[model samples]
Every structure is written in structure tokens, then in C-alpha cells.
Target chain A: MSDHQPSQKELPEAPSTAPTPAGISRRGFLKGAGITAAGTALLEGVQGFSREAVASTPKGVKEFGPEPFPVTLHINGKEHALQIEPRTTLADALRIQLNMTGTKVSCDRGVCSSCTVLLDRMPVNSCMTLAIDAVGHHVTTIEGISTDEQMHPLQAAFVRHDAMQCGFCTPGMVMSCVSLLEKNPHPTEADVRYAVSGNLCRCGTYPKVFAATLDAASQLARKA
Target chain B: MNSFTLADCSTVEAALSQLKDGAIVKAGGVDLLDRMKNGTDTPTRLVNIRNISTLRGIHSTPQGLTIGALTTLAEVADDPTIRTQYTLLADACGHAATPHIRNMATLGGNLLQQLQCWYYRSAEFQCLRKGKELCFAFSGLNQYHAIMDYGGCPSVAPSSGAVALLALDASVELTSAAKGKRIVTIRDFYLQPDANPHRFHVMAADELLTAIHIPKPAPGTRSAYQKYGEKESHDWAIADAGILLEMDSNLCRRAVVAMGAASPVVRRSHEAEAALTGKPITHETARAAGQASMTGAMPLSMNAYKVQLFPVAIYRTILLAAGQMDRDPSAAG
Candidate 1:
């Protein structure tokens, strides 16, 4: 099939009050937006803007900065205010600022769920989530899963089923399993596999991980 | 990742205002954060539009299904209405990325997400997609490159949502502070790299994708999506196909076939659709339609295997859509 190209000339004219696409080049627009090309040097000049400049900026205008600022992150039912750069990820903030080093940062990208955490009860890669973006949401890490130093049922099951080898992927594996069990207490083996498919264990402990998650589900059921 | 301000916008109007001056809109941040970490994207500021309530739900409209831009892939897949009405989309969403990614990745973001090309992602090679003169994949490793050459750039549009939406005949509602609001069909939204190497879609920088609308299919229409990947999990499709067929007493009334991963864009196979329309959907006819889908495929040097894989992907999806065959878990191979 022939590609359909929407004619630019046929597009309706923009409103006078609307922000015109006059001076903004496509390269310039894409460089700062969405999932376009990446090069840190493209935005290096933004670091020099002052707070006063930001204040004087238009209501809808953006202010760029690499400078550290104080922001509060509500994590695991507690709010911790810390000074961090806008680029600081939830994983980095938890590990470096608050000393909650339980959330591992292996790939540091979204691919590896080593830094898996619950952002408003949904599993998300903490390494890819910016600290500032997580401000209003509930952030639950591996360290927060337990209460009063007692291992969560999922964690206890992991130990029981020997769902660890090098133990690097355990924290993430446990967090993912906890989320699955919360949503589905009686998941099939296929459900368990689909739940933790994002969490990679180089140790090849998937069989044990599955066993532990199932056992934890049964345990939680009995307790209920 | 480079340092940038995070601008939190509470409304669509506010988000559009901040979308100017090298400010990128971020929702989910699955793809944006990954590109930032790879040093491929350096925005001066990130306009956080996640708080915009209007862009975060799924509703049925008189026209059809209207899905908010920020609706996650998991939500779309799990939505009972969508699962029953638009099974192709549900299957595509269920098979895309992984559970964690599906939870974080939004439908709008998935549609506009960048291709997962190794050279394009790597800082070492300044490929054409990055505004360079050359396409490194042409000379380097291109095993995952597009089989159909729609443009100079070899990277495929990696959205399963896009592939399924094409078969469903969906349209996107785009709103910009400048250009009030306009609806464009999914087929007209994409741009080949040859036409414009820099941008993937026709959306202006200031425009925001508000929602996706899938027109209600004709009665008795069934659809299915089949994706072929190297691995069972966490891998992009090597080639995928989505088939939508409207049956009239065991005879095909209307057929729409869309292919992805094999092409730079989610493409409709008009030849395949023509071959099946007004014909009985038997095993032989389905195979014939699948063969017709490969009319103009021009595989890259390393991706020649897709020539063999694309037809089977299309055939299986057609069978599944026609209720001729059960969904095989190992179809990706």
C-alpha cells in the first residue's frame, strides 16, 4: 500500500494566541522532546539560567537547570526531603541520599528491573524514574516491603525455596512477586512467569523464583 | 543523563505551553529515560505531563473506543471492552515488551517511541536518524533492521499498538496550544525517513497527542495479532502481523492486513487485503493472501530471514483471526 502523507498545506491555521511554530526548528524541537536523539551537549547551555530568570519566564514557559534543588520524595509511607539534581533517578536518590541501598542498579536502564519498585502500587523501573517525577506518588522499594524488620511473606518464601544464587536479582524479584500476589493471590504458573518476566536473574533461578512466588501466594491465602 | 529541569504540568493546556523551547513531554519515561541515559537525547527541560487528568482514561464514545494518551499498555490489554471488541490490540499489548514495561509505557508514548536500533541508540555512531549523513546499519550489524525499505533509515517502528491500531483503522486526536485540535488517521500519521529523516510522525513539536479513537468495526469482524521475535520475552518483534476480517456467512466481506517490524512503518498490505476480500477464507486462500502481502518487500542484507518469516507471521495471524487455528505460544520463532 502506498504511504499516505498528510498534506501540510491542508492543515488548519493556528490561532493567534497559540504558540506559533515560527522560530523552533525541527531538530531543536525534537532534541528536547519525547524519545528523540540523545546528546548531553545539546542541552549544556541550559545550566546557566538563574532562578530569577525562571521567575520572570512566562507562565507556560519552561526553565532549564542542572543545579541541585530541594525536593520531597514520599517513599514507603514516609516523606524525605533532600537536595538533588533534576536528573537524579529514584534509584539513585534511595541509594545515595536516604541510604536505602536495597534497590539495586545493575543496568541503570529500564531494561533490567533490578531497581524495580512500586510507584503508586504499579511495578516500575526505579532506575528510569526521575526522583522529581515520583514526588506525588507512593514509592515502595525492596527495603520498604517489610514491616518492623520482619521479612515479607514473599521474601520468606524466597529463602524457603532457595530462590537466590548470587542474590543480585532477589530484591527486584521479590518486589515484583509481591505486586503479583497482591493483585492475584491464586495465580497460575504461567501468571507467575509473566509477572516477573521483566526481572532478569542471571543466576538462572527462575524455577525457584516461580516456586517461591507460588508458595508465598499459598501462605498469604492461609493467613487470610 | 544530562541535567535538565523537570517542569510539572497539571493540565493539557499547561503541558502544551511548556512543550516549547526545547522542552520534551515525558510520561512513563520508559523510552525517554533510556535514551537520556544512552546520551542520545538531551532536552533542556522535561515537561512532566503525567498529572494531566484528562489524558489518563479509557472510555467508549459514540464513534467508537476513545483511549486517553496516558493510558498504559497494561490497562489497554486488561480492559474488558477492548479485549472483547478489539482483540487484536489486546493481543498486541499483551505480547509487547514485558509486564513491568506494559505497566509503565503509555499508549501515546508507545506510538511515538523511538526505534530500538543499536547504532541509533549508541553514541559511537552518528547515524542518519541522528541527522548525520550516513546510516550505519547499512554497513554494520542490521540483523534487526527493517526488511521493507520505505525510506533511507532502516530502523522499524517498534510499536505493537501501532500495528494493531492500523488493522483496527484507528485515528489519533492531536491537540496543540497553536493548532487547537485535529484528528488524523493512524495511516497518515507516520512519515518515512526518506521523506523526513528527523521526525517519525506528522505531529508538530507543540502538538500533544490527546487520545486515540478506533472506529467500531463492522459486525461479525474478528481480529488477531501475531509477533515473531527471537526471544519469548522482553524482545522487540523481528516481524509481526495483524489481521482484521469481517466475515459474511463464512465468506470474507472485508479484510485489513497490517505488518510491522518488517517495515519502517506499520504498513497495510492492500494486496493481501484484496486477495482475501469477497473470498472464502480457507487454508490455501489464507496462505495465498500471506504470499501476496510480500509484494514489494526489499530486505536488507542481514535481515533476509524476515522474507521467510513475514509471510508465516501474516498467515498465522489470519488463521487466528478467522478462528481457523489456535494461538501457538511458540509462533514468535
Candidate 2:
């Protein structure tokens, strides 16, 4: 896939919304409208979950809606009190709200680890973490790491090994590496490969990335 | 950063007192946000419950391991205690999504992640689960649908972690508005389509899955879990296998063989378990046990391949846990 965002010229024209095998009837339309209205209203208001409500509403309908919920998210050692929607993902919270854009948001889905971030000294896909759900969690984004003057050891190691190509994946890759070395200071080659199986590099920089992970681990191991 | 309201409750009673018809529990939000984004799941009130620290961490003792349902996949995977005892579950977490997803996705969230059915996800397709007349996945992309557990609604449960958890004899602690807190087995966590296809979990509307209690493995039991997908790694399992075996003087004293991505719940093989117990672990016995595991399977036209692949998984899992896959070269090689 191209690194460039989808340009309007590159985008396809809107397709016609034709009725398929089973078209929506008036009653069906009303029902769909009712559901949309209910969900939108809940997202707009962001209130009202009780045990009784849980008991009343059936499963499979996904009764959760968007709401302005207060959360105290700890990034690095700093605590941030922010109002977020129930549906707002930690990835969006970092990229959009906190303005920490180092953690890329290529795959909005949780499949790719482009949005990997540390939570309580472990790495996870920020895109999949619900901000409301992450209340009281210790979230460490790429920005939360490294001092103003000194770069983190992992970052320095990546630079030393020339591990990056386009550098789009550096932040998340380094974060995942940091998590791996933290748990296993001296990982075998297979261990390092398996640890980062979740992340992808479009430039196919696995060899260099693997070397950087090893180099960083060695450097950190010596310091420790 | 977007806006939303909060309804915090220590008990189900406080939440239900204010909740009428449209409230939803907000646990870790991994699945909740997807529902919100797709316009498929929405509740008038979003109940926040992660603050209840009591509902976190794994409780491991001689009898069993009691894991909070809200426990993160990373916690379940990395717990030195769990990695030592319940290696099956630890492997499941290590295999789920990627490192990042494992961090945010909770055991509860993984178990309750929305079905991967394309029809249900698309706003246009009104599948049977969503109150529609027919399910296009039946005729369309039926490759991933259930085989044995299909007679009723044909959706597959999306929990790879739950499968290993159940194989370890885990149970859940559910908090209800009316009934208070209660415990049930991980096997009881699911509801089959033959009973109610609309939902997968058996918990009541007012009930919340607060914790899970997993019994420790028997003295000599060793367990292993392997999830096979199209990709060698970093992908959802198209087929998954879990095995727990207790060895007594070179003879298999007890065995539990479970498979997921096969049904709405992890399918345990009683016949396979029976064949292995009180018998010496051998290549022939392992192969026979594998055959008996999927004996009564009725696969869909597309997913029938599972029936074939399932047996190999059964055999391999048995030999692997028995420490025979690497040691013995008698076809269990």
C-alpha cells in the first residue's frame, strides 16, 4: 500500500445504493431508524447503564453508546485528566487529543500494531483500547518516553543499527521492542522474532529490525 | 476526547435502579467501541466498571486459579504463576492478536468480542442473529462458520483465550442486580444456539462477569494449547486445539481435549478423553483418540474441512503434551 493518504483523485466515485435481494420495507425502515436514533441519542448523551438496564436489554444488540466520561490516564509518570467518549480508543486519544503523533494510526483496526503503546510497562494496540475503559490505567505513548534532551535507549539503538527505512513504524516498533527486552533481557533469535510477529514493516526491514532489537537488548543488559 | 456520560455503580442494584431499557456495561471498551463505530451496538447509558479493582488479577492456589473476568490478556499471558501452571491459557493470550491487543483486550472482552460474521457486521445485511430472516454467511462466506454446533444459529464464538481457560476447569463470578454474586464454570459461560441463538453467553442482562476461577492442574498433569491459522503467526486461529493430560507411571490417568473455532463454545471431546484415560500414551492411541474426538461432527459445506484437520490437531496435541512429539518417533514423531 502507498504511504500517501487516499487522494480524492485516487478515490473511486460513490456507488449507487441499489436495493438487494431483501429490500427494506417501511416497517423495517422505521425499525432501523428507531435503532439509529436510540444509539445516536445515547452516544450524544453518554449516560444510563445500570444493572437493571443490563438485565432488561438483550445481548447481541451492543447497548454501549458514546458518552463524555472522565478518565485519569497516566502516561509515563504524568497524569492526564481528560473527558472522552465511551467509544474513543486510546489510539485516537493519543493521536487526536494528546497530539502525540509519533504512534502512527495506519490500521484503525487492532490487527496491525502501528498503534502499539505501553500500558503498565507492557505493549498493546492503542487503537483497540477504549479510552473510557482504560480509566486509571498507566498508558505510555512514544511521547511519554524519553527526556527533552536525552533519547530513550531503544531509540538510540534503532538509530545506531539503522533499523528504519521510511521510519513510519519506528515509534511502535521501538515500543514493542522495549516491551520485549523488558521481559526477556537476553532473548534468543526465535524469541525476538515471535515477540514482534504482530508488527509489520512495509519496507520489509525484518533483518535490520531484528538486529536493532538484539543490539538494544545488549546495550540495556550491560547498563542493568 | 469525544463526549459521553457516566453511570458508575459499585453494585448492579444502583446501576439497574437508574437503567431502564438502554444501558450497557463498559468494561475495557475494546469491543464496545467497534460496536459504537459500526452503529451496531449502542446503549443509552454506558456503565463504567474497570475502577472496581477487586475485579482484576488472577487468583491462583492449589484448588484453582480465580481470574477476574476483567483481567487483561497480557496479565493472563505474562503472569509467571499462570505461565508455569496454566500454560495452555498463557499460550492462548500470547497467540491472540498481537502484543498490543493483548495489553488492552481483556479476557472478558476477548470472550465477548463481536462475532466475525460479515453479515452481522455490515449494516445492510440483516442476519438471523440480528433479527433478520436469513443469514447470507450461510451461502456466502461460510468457510468460518460453525460445523458441529450449527443446527440452530450458525455463528462461531470469537474467544480463543476462553477455550484454553475452560480446558483448565475455570469458572466465572457473575454479579447480578437481583441475585448478587454467583460462580459458574467456564463451560457454562456459553449458551448454544439449539437453546438461544440470539446470544452466546448465559449471563443475564443485569449480570456482569466479574471474575473467573480456574482450578489448578492436577499433580502430574501437563497442558499445551496450539492455535493454527492460515498465517504461521499473528492471525486468528482457523482451528485451535487444547490438551491437558495427567500421567501416572507412563499410563494416561486423565485427559481433556478441547477444540475452538469449531462451535459457539469450545468443543470438548469426551470420547477422545475416554480413549486416553487409564491407557498408555502411544501413537496408535493418540491417532484413535483424535478420530473419536470429531466422530459426531456435522460440518457445514464450507467448514467441513475442519473435521479432517481437527483429528490431526487432536493427535498432535496429545503427543505434544505427553512429551512424545519430540521424543517418540513412532508416527507421533
Candidate 3:
């Protein structure tokens, strides 16, 4: 392979114990250079802090994988037993492994709230959460919000208000609002906006989303 | 993300033990997941410390408040005591990122988050923070880069939580199986870019931040935080200010002023704090303090507007802490 990048010798030292896999990712290459800089940077003042940290002796501690692990996740009140890679995210577990495609994965980096889900009723980015991390928590997705074939109040209001244009951000937006309404049943316009602030709708349906959520709040209030 | 084995640690000791052998700690996994996805950090083993129940919660003591490292930003933001007493911290936590991120982002993790510089985050640009030779922000689009104490890298401190904690005079506790535990003031926790551009804070890779200790405020002390972004919501601060004032009626007996996103690390403006202390917080005094806050600022090619924005942010934050300002200063800016 003809490499245009600088030679490995020109790069900075890698962190002493950070294992370099056979395939050096772009970041890995840069990280090697960074560790070398850190070594020189810490030499003067932070030597005591950095060296001791890097020199810690490895004990017989439990470890799990550069491979797959069996994990049980509680999703929508049901237990799922599956073999998943340690690196697999909760969003992938739901969408790919279990075939629950309602949850979207727009920004895999958690910038957009397209993959928002409820973990123990608190809203979190499903793509940012590890599958094993959701083992004991209750995972709720857009599909699980509906009760017995009846649309959730928020979902019904979203449809009535035409809150979605392309509907890509709907699941995450709905999930974020669902959490808010569950806690604050009578949320104001500002509250609704704040609740869905994490959700990005490039389709420009924010005004409609606010209207749908406020309308759903009143509907839930009427039933109560 | 590179594959790794996940070890669900039930105890801090267990987590610390697993911290060795090319393993990394996972708190809220907000920042860690970003690095993993970017391929910047590829740990073969992940020490899942989220399950350590002992490492979660906020405890109030007669001396002050001791918050566990695992306490999420949402928990801190919603705590009634924190809201009523440490309103600066509450505002910083509440207004950070968004509701979803706040729920998963822990106070400790927020304090130690890596720089938000585009050149650093993107793998394509090997900025100095990532161990490369040059900071692209020096010659590239740096509208959001630091203006004060940037040193070698122009990356700004990304944590609003650290800004509040610095003004509140908080300290963090870091524990390692090898070295036990040590407490360092929040101001000292962060390292300037010149010291080590590669590391954001002083917590060694093996050390785990265990707790944040905040002393009880003296009577008559009030505080507030103001963050200004180009977009009103869900954006990093263009200039954020946290002000703490010990007031006797209208007179400011003492002051602590901290500014974030203006420098490589969250910095306390001794000049600004000196300007406010022993003076009544009025339009003149607040304006003077704001000016003092920017005494040594050096703006980059595309970020001179921040130099103007920060003074306004500091001015309003001081007034807000003293109950003289009603509307958000950020809104005006």
C-alpha cells in the first residue's frame, strides 16, 4: 500500500499499554501522536500524576471482550435474550437484533435525538447507550408507547396536527414528549418546547410538534 | 466502534481493578461513546462503572453537599436544594445540551469531557489536541475557538458545569486502587493546553473521579450562570459566565467570577472578581467587572465577536447574581 501519510517514526509515542490492533484506524494513528505529546507535556509538572497512572499494575480483574457477549435486556416490559458484541449500542439491539425499526438512527453520534428512547422512563439517546447498560433498566420505544392498538395521546395529536413532514424525527420527538407528559401532565408551551429541544426536525415541524404536545396534554388532562 | 468486552462493575474497587489492562471507565458513556464512534479511543475492555450504586446520589452534609461522581446532570439540575442554594450550578446543568443528554451525562463526565474543537473531533484533521503537530483552528474556521489563554491549541473548554463549580469553589475527589483518594479544587482539576494539550483534566486514565465536594455558601451569598450561544438552545456556549457574590444588602462583600468557552480551560477572572468585591453591584461596577474579565483576551481571526459577547455575558451574569437583572443577558446579546 502506497501511503501518503507521514511515516510511523515521525508520529508521537502511543500510550504505553494501549494495544495497537493490526488495522490502525485514523484516530489510532493520531492518538499515538497525542500520547507522545502528553508524555513530554507531563514530564515537567504532571510527571507524578501521569507516570503513576500509566504504570499501574494490572490485577486479576474480571474482563469481558473484543468479541460477543450474552446479554439480557428488558425492552417494553419483555425480556430479550441475545448474543451481542460488547460494542453494540442499545439502538442497534432494538432495531437490528430484535427488528423493532420504529426507532430511527439519524445521528449515530448522539447529536440529534432521532434515536431517543426511555430508559427507566428517563429520556436517553439509544445510540449513545450500550446494550449491556440497559440490562436492568426498562427500555421503552415508540412502538411500546401505544396501548392495546389505541394510539398514545401524543401520537394521536401528532397525526391530528400534521406534526410530521417526512416523519424521520417523529419517534424521538414523540418519545421525548411522552416522558415530559408522563411527569408533567399539564406542560405549558415553553415546557413542550424545552422537552423536545433535543430533537432535530430538519423538516421544520417544530411549531406543529409543540401544538401536538400541548394538545395531547389537554387530552390527557380531560381523561384524568 | 472497535469491539470491547463490557464488565459491569458493582463496586468502585472492582471498577478500579478493571481500569488496567487497556480498559477504560464508562460513566454516562456520553463522551466515551463519541470517542469510540470516532475511533479515537478503542479500549479492549470497558469498566462499566454505571452499575456501582454506591457511586450515585447527592448527600447533604452540615459542611456542604457531597455529590457522587455518577450523579447525572438531570439529578443535580432537579435537586431542590441545588436549585434553591446553588442556582448557578442548577442553571448550568439544566441548560446544558438538552433534556436527553442531561439525563445521561454525569457531572463528573461533563467536567472531564474532551474539547469540542471541530479539528480535534474530526479524524480527518490531526489537531494538536489529538497529538498532531499543529492546531488547524489557528488557520481554519475558528469562530467557536478560544480567545483567552488558548496556549498552543485554540480549543475552548466545553463544560458549563466546570464554569459553575469554579465560581462555587467546589473540589473533586479522584480515587484509584493504587493511590487511594485525593481531593483537588475544581480550579486545579483542569489543565491548561500548554501543560498537556492531549489531556483536558488531571484525572489520570487509571483514576476515577468519585465525588464533588461543595462547601455550604456563607449567608447572603447568591450566584447565577448565563450561557450565550448563537442558537438559543441545544448549542455550546459562545460565551458563558458564572458569578458568585457574597452580598450585604446592596454591597458586594466578596465575588468569584468564572468564564467558560473563552479559554482552553474554564478560567476564574481574578481581575473581574476583584472589581466586584467590596463594591455595590450597579451598572457601572458590573460594566467595569465585565471589562476586567477580558483584560488579556486575544481573539482569533473569526472569533473577535466573542471578545465583545463575553463582556456583555459577564456584565449581565454579575447583575443577575445580584438580583438586579431580570431578563437573560444572553437574550439581549
RMSD (Å) per prediction:
13.1, 9.9, 11.8
Candidate 2 regions exceeding 4 Å error are A1-83, A132-138, A147-150, A222-224, B1-4, B9-20, B326-333
Q: Which tens-of-lDDT digit does each residue in B143-171 have in candidate 3?
A: 99999898898888899999999988899
Chain B fold agreement for model 3, TM-score: 0.97
Clashing pairs in model 1? A37-B40, A37-B41, A38-B39, A38-B40, A38-B41
lDDT of 2 by residue, B1-333 (tens): 233445555543555454444567766676776666666765545676655566788776667777887788878988998887788788788778766666667887787777877678767787777766686766778787777766656667678887787788878788876788888777887877667657767777777777777876888888877776766555666777788888897988999988877776777889999989999999999999989988778887688888887788778878887778841122110
User: Which one wins on DockQ?
Assistant: 1
Q: Positional deviation of B78 in candidate 2, in angstroms?
A: 2.8
lDDT of 1 by residue, B76-176 (tens): 99999999889999999888887888888899999989988999888888988888889988778899888776578889888999999998989999999
Cα displacement (angstroms), candidate 1, residue B253, comes to 0.7
* lDDT by candidate, in order shown: 0.83, 0.72, 0.84
The stretch of ten residues in a row with the least summed lDDT in candidate 2 chain B is: B324-333
DockQ each: 0.29, 0.23, 0.27
Q: Is candidate 2 or candidate 3 better by DockQ?
A: 3
lDDT measured at residue A174 in model 2 versus the true structure, 0 to 100: 83
- Candidate 3 lDDT (Cα, whole model)? 0.84
**By descending TM-score, how would the candidates be arranged?**
1, 3, 2
| DockQ, Cα level, model 3 | 0.27
